[model samples]
Structure formats: C-alpha cells, structure tokens
Target: MKKYALLILFVFPISRTAWAQSPEVLAIRKYGTQNADKMMREFAAFLAIPNIARDTVNIKKNAAFIMSMMTERGIKNVQLLAPSTAGAPPAVYGEVKVPGATQTLIFYAHYDGQPVNPAQWAPGLEPFKPQLYTGTIDKSGKNIPFPTDGQYNPDWRIYARSASDDKAGVFTILSAYEALTKNGLVPTSNLKFFFEGEEEAGSPHLNQILEKHSALLQSDLWIICDGPVHQTGRKQIVFGVRGDAHMDLTVYGPKRPLHSGHYGNWAPNPALLLAKLLASMKDDEGRVTIKGFYDDVTPLTASEKKAMQEVPSVEAQMKRELGLSTVETTGAVLNEAISVPSLNINGMQSGNVGKMASNQIPTFATAVLDLRLVLGNDWQRQQQKVVDHIKAQGYHVIDHEPTDDERAQYGKLIKVIPGEDGYNAQRTPMDLPIAQRVIKAVQTTTTDPLVLQPTSGGSLPLYLFKKYLNANTMTVPIANHDNNQHAENENIRLGNLFDGLETMTAVMRMK
Candidate 1:
C-alpha cells in the first residue's frame, strides 16, 4: 500500500499566529496532513467506480459510496433523493444542523462525469484507474508511483475521470465536514449536502428532483463547489452561469454513398454542405451570424462592470500557454466574451478518416451544436433561432429523415433535433448579504484578493434552484483553471485539493 504526505505551503506571508490559525482551519489542515495517505487511498477507491450519469448501474454504486462517507461522518438524514423517472440517478442528501443557527446553506457538487472514450486517453493512463503524476501530461509530466510513506508534494496531480470536474468537489465538501466534526468545531450555520448525480447530462431531470424535495431543500443560499478557480491562480466567487442547449443537425447528400470520381460534380458532398452551413452561422471574426442571436443579451450591472474591470489581465498569459496568436474578435476580453451568448460546434461526423477513408461521398453529415445562453435569453427561443436560420438558407428542414419523394423535390434536405430540456441563465446580485459573507469567509483563508465575476462561461442548472426553491446561489470553484476538466487526462492538483478543504471549512465556519 502506498502512503502520501501533505505539505502546507501558504501563498502569502503571515505571522506565527497565522500558522496556528482558527480551530476550523487548523483542524482541517491537521486532519488533512495526518490522514493524507488514508484520504488518497479512499479517494482513489471512490474514483475507481465508473460514474457516468447514463450508466445507471455504476452511478448507483457511486451514490452508495458517498452515502457511506456522509454516514460515517455522523451526518443526519443521509439518504438518496430519487427523481420520478425510474433509473435516473438520485441526489445524495445529508444535513448537519447546528443548534441555534439561523442560516441554512446547501453545499452542492455533482458526482457524475462526462462520458469517456478510452481510446482518447494518453497511452499509459485509463480514465477510471486513478494515477498520480508529477505534473500535467501536457508538459512532459510522467506518471509516478504513489508515495509509500505519508508525505506528498502539493504540486503532484492525480489524473482520472471526474478528478477535477466534480469528484473533487464531492471529496472536498465531505472531507471538510469530517475535519470540522473531528475537531469539535461547530459551524455557525446549518449545513446541508446535496450531491447531484446527473449534472454532466445537462441536468435534464434536476428540476424534477428539486420539485419533489423542495421543502426539505429549503436553504438561505446554495454554495456550488464546481468549475475552476480564476486563471490567475486566485480563488473566485462567480455570481452566475450561462444557460445551455444543444442541437443535432444532419444534412443529406444522397440516398447511398456514391463514388467521388464517377459522380464528382453530379453528386453533392454532405460534408461540404454541412461545413458551408456551419460557416454561415459564424462570421470571419467568429461572431454568430444567426438572427437574434445577440438580441436577448442583457447588459451588465454597474457593479458587475466594475468587477470585470478589476479582473487581472490573463489573456497574454493564457495565449502563450495555449500557443494562440489571437482569440475571437467578438469580445474585448475573455470575461466579456463569456458574458454574451455564443454558439459552438461540439463535434461533427461524416464517414471515416485515416486508413478507413474511401473514395466515396458519405450519405450524410451530422454535427452537434451547442448554444450558450446569457441572462435575457430563453433556451427554447435560442434553439428556434438556429432552426429558423437553417430554413432561411433554402434547405428543407424536417425533424426526422426525409422521404425519397421529399428528398427528390428539395434541392437541400436537413434535419434538426433539439435537446429535450434546457434551463435559462441564473444570477444572484453580487452585493447580497449572503454573497458578502461568502466572500469574507473565503478571503480569510487567502491573503490574495479573491476574483469576483458576474458569470462563468460554463453552464450549470442553477436556474432550477431559483425556480423551485427560490434560493440565492453562488459558485466558489476550487479546482485549478488548467485542470483539463471534461477532457482526456482530467486531473486535480494536490495543492488545489488541499486549499479547497481549507476554503470549504472557512465557509462552514462563516459568521
């Protein structure tokens, strides 16, 4: 069995008293250090379980494991909140009510991960078999054997599916609670844990779960532990998240694959048609050209504008790291670009490539489109605009495959399949009392200033929280910005995980 040690490297200078710290912070650090090896082993055990939301059998196993963790920590009301739809993954719920505490805060994190393609992973690493690396794989970081003693380098990273996107959130939140209880430090507010099981699947059934458990989930606020910290390596408190919707588009070329040479000019190429269609949606500068795409975007508030301005300039650093000469010209800055609605091509497919390539035109080409919504946009309306744009391009649009007669009549044939459910964007005021308390709590742990942003570029089903529970929500992300979330070789830096433990502890101890 391998052992790991926890190394504490405080980012800012502080007196000896700072090393002593408050009981909660001190306890978290102590517990994390003393049990570093045990924690790593336990985390590895949890990460080994396949937790794709669509995989019902495996997802339940993850829920059961989490329930055991919470129950062992002496959490009350630890149970699964299942949705009405059978087989849908359930949300694991637990609570720790502090006596005489007036405020109740729900800490949320999803356990399910994005679907994986094993072939896409690096040569030696697999998604579910968590491995320790000296650093990220992109920079020639090599896989290292797990430490046999209880000492670990904070710079080391653990790569596995959901290592940073969310399983990290689950482990950090529960571990923080364990640290508090072990040290006999009672939180100032009542704490509730809600571990979602289907966030990566667009949270299609989250509203159902929320509606069914509204009364039990009532809380003053929800602190979402997801996403990455600011690119500048500082903690961030995001007030909002963009909305999300996806579309599947298929354009037909012929009833059957035709030889490119024999029917060169006679038969149209679906790949070329799909490419042209996608090109029409974006201009040379990468702005979406779809009608009404930007019409619904709401302008930022004065405070939000100030927050945006205060954000450190990380564009140059990011460009250098990403090896990019320039970014999209649509927005003045990365922060501003995320604030507006945008369209993206998640993926596209037409026939095969490489050794499988053939000298024939594919029967059809398909593309998966992602639409990100801002505050004023409606998900359904946003999707409709894209469908309408396709129609305006002189194509015959259908929800399903076209008949032979119809295909023969129309010069261009296409199909658009929109996603079932999509929630709109949600944002809480930055100046709210609860928001300020959260800011202050997080600030206590770090000497550097925290990044306060109006919104994150990513989407969360936070709007459902507002609609069903009317709860004020804020995101305090704790993973490294370069954690490679949702991509192959997903990982969480040991330092980020340790810092997150301290951050969550401080939030629970908020006054």
Candidate 2:
C-alpha cells in the first residue's frame, strides 16, 4: 500500500485536524507521496521541450499539452486565445469555476523561457537535457554533497529552460490539483488561469490581450506563480515585484576601424568614449548619477522598513557562495539591497581581435543595460535619463530608427531599443482580508514562520493584473533559493517542489 494509504489507516483515524482537510486535499497529498517520481518525470518531459522565446511552435505544443491534461483531468472551460496581433502565437487560457464561490482568484504564469545558447551550458548538461543531481553550494562556492559517489537523490528533479522561472510552478499547481481531486479535495474559490506565451519576450502584447478579454480576465485577486523562494529557505509571500526595463546605448565614431599604431594618438576611440559615458552614470558609492532619476520614486513606509529589517541575512554565506570578500553598497542589509532601484550593464561589445589581439581603435561601442525600477518611478522618464545623459555628454541620441541623414552623419548611428516592457513594482496591503487568509493558509502548510515581503528585486508583470484588472496580487514561490533561475545549470529541489504542492493544496483547501 502507498504512504497516503498508510497515512489514512494510521494517522487520519485518530486525528482531529483530519476533518480540517478536504477529501481532495488528503487524497492529493497521499497521491503525491506515492507517485512523486512519476510526477517528476512528467515535469522533466515538459522541460525537455525547448519552449524558448519566439519559438511558439513548441510553446503551442506545450500549451496544448496543458489543456489536454486539464481536459483529461476533467477540468472545464479550457480555451486557446489567439494572439492579439497578426503573426503572434496564441495563449492557452483555462478556468474551473467552483459553484457558489463568491471570490475569484486569477493564477498567472508564463510558458515561455529565455532563448538558450548551447555553448553556455556545462558539459553533459545541454539546455534541453534535464538531469537530476544533489549538491548544496555553500558560502565558499564549494558544492557539498551528501554522498559523492555519483548517487543523486531520486526525488530531486532538474531541468533546463524556465524550470523554475515558471514551468515548475505550472507543474506544482496542476499536480496539486490532480493530487487533490484524486484524493477528494476541492478548490474553495472560483479560479482563473492565465498562462502567457510571450512573457519571455517582455509580454509585448499582453495589454491588448487583457483589454480584449476584460470579462474573462476579471478577478478579485491574482497570484503570480513565478520567481523563487527567499535566500533563508523560509516560505515567502511577496506582495509586489520590482519592475525591469532594458536599453542599449552606443557611441559612434569613424567610418571604419582605425589602426591603433597609425592613429593611436589621433583617432578618438568609441569604446573609450562609451566607457567614460557609462562611468559618469554611476558614482563610486553606486548611486545612479542620472538627474532627477529618483525624483518620483516612492519612499518606503515605516511599516515596510520594519518588515524588511526582520528578514534574515546570510551575508557571510552569500560572500562565500559568490567568492567575494564583501558586498557593494554596504551598510544596509541584504533586503535593503533589493529594495532600491538599480542599473546594471548586462553585456557590452564593440570591436574584436583574434588571437594575438589587434591594435585597432574600434569605430563603435555598445552596451546592453538593464534598469530596475522601484514603485512610483516612471519607466519612460527613467529610460530617458540614460539617453539624455548620453546626449548631454555630446553623443547623438538615437531615440528611434534614425533617418538616412542622421545615420550618415553619426557614422552608422547610435540606437536605443527597449528590450522588455517595463513593469511598475506592486505592493498589496497586508491588511487586506485575502492577504491574511493566504498568510494563515501558508502557515498551516509549513513548519516555519512565513516571510512577508513588500517587494522582490525580480521582475514580474504583477502590475498588469493589478493595473488592468484592478486586482490585488500576491506570490507564493516554491523554488529553492539557489535554483539558478535565469542562469545556467538551473534545477529545482524535490523537497521544495513537494512543499510547494502541499502549500498550494492547503491554499486551495483553505476556507
């Protein structure tokens, strides 16, 4: 017999709280324990399909796979929404309305992932090949394993491509439901599902989709099932997420690459020009030098600051893991680090020389920059500061596809294109009744005290659900702290996945 069956025979018979769980919840927990490996296999299969950004064909198959599974599970009201624009792929929308439920909760996640380049992945661990391994990366960057004889935990599941960035959330939610229904637990509220396909591409058309289906997307609250758990391994409930935007700026010079020896002292190097321009945007203290950049940012409330002060800090552990002696922007703790806006150079490139380097002054240089916005900051205005600063530094502002004359005059022109549609940070009032309910529900499922965060440094389109649908949003993330989300060698812990499923089950069964 299965563990759940043993649980029923041995534990449920004498338990007073056994009555607290719905039959479905009880059944699901049992089913999850008995068939955890099978569930992990299904998750691995989903991860195996390469559903990177703009690769909508496989994404469609993956979406269809979700709908098919929902259908086989007897879930109703499943539909595929066509892309709002021509040439865009569709989004799979589904819902299962519970009768007599007054409150509706919209669950959001993306089925898309960032594009992967095979060369960046480790040997024997290609982007599409899912592998299971167990090792804890300690403070010193050393991976300490329980047993180092090539024996991996059979319970742990690791996969490439959005496994934690969101496919894990999808599997956990779906499997939680399956576990519930198979065991006899029923959801307490009317549920809406919004699985987006273009989020990895900054969700360019999400606004149109939301506007088009205003009725279908209606909800009192939204629960984003993205991101990962806090660094302290405590279960977290995030009220908001920071907004993110990307920009690329370039400095232009001569028509062609100049020989360094010939014009070493004469020709102006765009690379050097760009480096100087970027350096001017940030001071030695790491404060952004863009004029009026923080003018509109909302200050943290006393309550928010108090909440942040209570979060655990493993600074030494972090320094060890990163192999760093110290952290930048010191004095304020770890939580304070993510609470503020930040500017980062994602990548930079200009001229390249093979082997024994070329002594050539590059004609042009460009940097891909990402600017994370805090609440109340204007996306367009903040982006403008970077461009305005560049122009203020005597460089041409390439605001759009330049005219022929401008391109010719600027020596091939500087360009600035927005990468991801920026999101404004969100913060739900902890005083909200639903927030309290969720806090209690998560607590009942976890052994430790829950972490209540005002905002996360990561980016999520929670703003859309709140701004467009007038809904309060929250996040219950289950991925481990070191899940390597958005980085190479991404994997999810078996224990975390199980805990998340159990938590979700508890939430669904909450009164």
Candidate 3:
C-alpha cells in the first residue's frame, strides 16, 4: 500500500576482489570529511522547510533555497523550469560546462516528499525538526544535539520527510559538484543538475516541464540519484525504474448508515462489498487475478535476468526482519518478485474502528489503489483492466455517484476514479556503453562490488525522459535500506549521504 516493499540490509561481505578507489574518490572523501558538519547542518536546515508539492507557498520556499544552493555552488544558468500548467511545482535546473567536455549528464533527483501526518511520527521527533538520531527510532535510537564540531558519526541519521527520498539526492549531487570545484577537480563531462519538486506527487506536470525545456535538458544519460542502495549494504547501480499509477475506488451501499441492531443481516454492507471486490482482484498467492493484469509486461533480458540472480538473496532475511514466516510470492525470491507488475491497496476506509466503532453499517466504502507498472505496461490500459474486472464481478461501475434511478436499478454499484498522474516504466539496456561507463565510475567509489540491478523495486517517471529527449537513465541509490521512506520517521544515514557524494564525484570525473 505505502510501498511496503522492504530492502535487505544485511551487511555484505567484502571480497578480495573489492573495487580499487580512484584519486578522485579519495579527494571527494577527504573533502566530505572536512566539510561533513557544514553539509549536514545545511541539509538539515533545508529539510526544515515544508516540501509538500501542493503547498505552493512552502514549495516555493524550497525552490528558492535550492536555487541559492546552486548559485552558491557556482552552477551556471541556474533557473526554475516551470511547466505550462499554472500552479504546478517547478523543477530546479542548473549546469556546469567543462572546457573540453563532449558529453552531458543530468544528475536527477526530486526536492518534494510524501505528505506527512505529524501525529504518526514516533515520540521525540517532528517531520520538519530534522532530529539527529543515533539509529532508527523504532530500534531505540537516541536523540542528540547537532554537533557544531566537525566530529560526527557516519551511522547517525537525520530524520525528516525527504531526508532520504530524496532531498538527500539534491544535497548529495550538489555537494559532489562543490567538493570537485573546491578541490580543483574539473568534471570530465559537462554536468547538469535537475531537481523535480513533485516526484512524490507522481510528477503530473513533468511532461509539461520536459516539453517546454527539451532543448536545455538534452543529455547522454541521466544518472538518477534516488531510492536506496542494495539491502546488503553493497553499493548498487540500477539501470531502470518501475512506473506508477494510482486510483480511488468507492462502492455504494444503503443511502444512509443503518443501525446494525435493526438492519444487520438485511441491509447491504458496503465494507463487505469493497472487501470482496479487492479480494477478487488478487488470488490467495497475492497475484492479481484481474484478467490481463500481467499480459503486457516485457520479460527481462537474459543479461537482466542474470544480473538479478547475482543480486544477494535477501528473501529469508527480509521475511525474518519483517516478522513474517512466508512471502506473498510463493516461489520467486525478492528480486524476481518485484521485477513484475503489482497491485497494492494503499489505504482503505469503511466507517470506523477501535474507539470510533459503531453498531451501524456504513453508507459507503472507499479505497485508494496503487498500481505499479513495468516497461511494456501502459498506465491507462492497466487501469482499464481493473475497471473491466470490477464489471466482471457484476458491479455496475461508474465514474461518479449514481443517480437515484440508476442506483435503484443496479444491485451492485461502484465508482472508479483514476488519477491523472500515471506514467509508464523505463529501462536502459544493461550492456549499453554509457551504462558500462556509469557502472565503472560508481564501482570506483567503493571497495564492495557494485550491485547491477535491472530495475529498482520502486517507481519513477523515467520513461518520460526517453519519450521527450530520447535519453537513457540509470539509478545509483544512496539512502539506507531501512530509512522508512514515504512513511513516518524517514531518514538518511550520514554514511550513505557521504558515500553518495563520492559516487557522484566519481561520475563527474569519469573518463
């Protein structure tokens, strides 16, 4: 529902064949150490800003702060790329041209974050206060004052919305550029920085922004610095991302709440109707039973399949960590499981629960559904499959509330309203030359072998880059696997943040 997919965080064993660090990585790490406090404090201050995309006033404040960050870093041609859609969140863009560079690379990340409910965060933490914790909050992490001295623990985390998904992306990439510039390490390729402000909002106006700025956004590759690294604590460089789509569902019952004492057994309950409908979509094994739900997925390439096998087996560990004896996918492992499409119930509502429970049947029931897509799946078509399945279930599916006459005529009625922000999946070939170069650059940043993933288990509108600019994209994630992204008490470990710096700088110094 809320991206319940968990990444494996078991510490990966380093082998004798560990990556050899380059001079650039050494320089970047040194620079990061010297400036770690300044970086965290700056990032913490930035995180203090409310960054919900729909909050125009506060969102603007975030943009201004990022622009200042760019200007201060000496990134030239800095500007906000606004879409034609008025009031839509604007993307922050800037670039640095290397004198003899022949190629351009866009370092992509988002500035906005998932909406938060302060009450949901654990005690001693606030979404915007940016508390420094000794470890994850739920594990008895301790809260301590932000240190003025440069001394700090790399394992310590800064908990805040977007701390990991992915204001840290902005902080990491920009800080890499700063480290390089400050240390006279000129980038080998012309570097462009683009930060979307509404990725968490599903990048609804991303198309408009790309349409308006296609010329300025051209790049040989877009190295997306989002999501998390391998669950095994191994550095990973993913070549693709899944797409995402969402919809809201409503099933009608009696015109008004009916007292269970009088109408219990006689009155139709919408909650049961909605529950049955959802159950009908998925089988006992958790596979969506909706016809054609998996029909359009593009099978992974042989190389991609091989890469997945090479990924550490975290299935058993993940299940244990999650306190589950079994997983939804009966036979497949975690990596194999997420490579396909998925149907998730993000949130469901009936009448009331716990203290609010009442002996009455609700007038209606509602649910928000999240549909994740792969390369061959079309967002619009995928949504239609569910709608079709509902019809197959004998529900009179409508897009809005049914009129009195229509309601009386149909025994089962439901409303299906899909969001307009849906987008398709995108993946770059794992063997492309640019992809190889990226893998090499990232590999230089750490001694642990780089995990080459076919697709991240999460979603992003990466396909739009190909649709608009014919650009290839890859992801090099930085957040700790258990950062609690898109949920309460989100965080980014200091080590991951600083490692991300070296990774970006390595790409900047790519040969």
399-468: candidate 3 lDDT, tens digit per residue: 9888999888999999999988899999999999988988888877777677889998899999999999
For residues 1-511, write the lDDT of model 2, one tens digit per residue: 4444434432332111332354543455556657755676677788888887677678778888878867777767888776569756566777878888888877777888778877877665677777665443222222322332222342344647777878888888777777777776678988777788878788887877887888888887777788877776778888877888889786676768888999988877878878888899988877888888778888888777777777777798788877898666757667777788889999888888578468898877889999888898767778887777776766667666556578567643567776657767777877788888888887776545677888888887677766677879899888887777777767777667766777787777667
Is 1 or 2 the stronger prediction by TM-score?
Answer: 1
Instruction: Write down the TM-score of every candidate.
Output: 0.96, 0.89, 0.95
Segments in model 1 whose C-alpha atoms lie over 4 Å from true places: 1-24
Clashes of 3: 1
What's the number of clashes in each of the models? 5, 9, 1
How well is each residue in 1-511 modelled by candidate 1, as lDDT tens digits? 3222243443221211233355567667777777788788989999999999989999999999999999999999999999999889999999998889999999999999999999999999999999999888888888988876767777788999999989999999999988888888889999999999999998878999999999999999999999999988888899999999999999999899998999988899999999999999999887889998999788899999999999988899899999998897645789888898989999999989999999999999999999989999999999999999999999999998899898889999999999986779988999998889999999887767888999999999899999999998999988988888999989998878878888999999998
C-alpha-based local distance difference test score of model 1: 0.89
**In candidate 1, which residue pairs clash?**
4-150, 4-151, 5-150, 5-151, 5-152
Give the Å error, residue 129, model 2: 2.2
Q: Per-residue lDDT for 315 in model 1? A: 90
Q: Which candidate's lDDT is highest?
A: 1
- Give me the runs in candidate 3 sitting further than 4 Å from their true place: 1-21
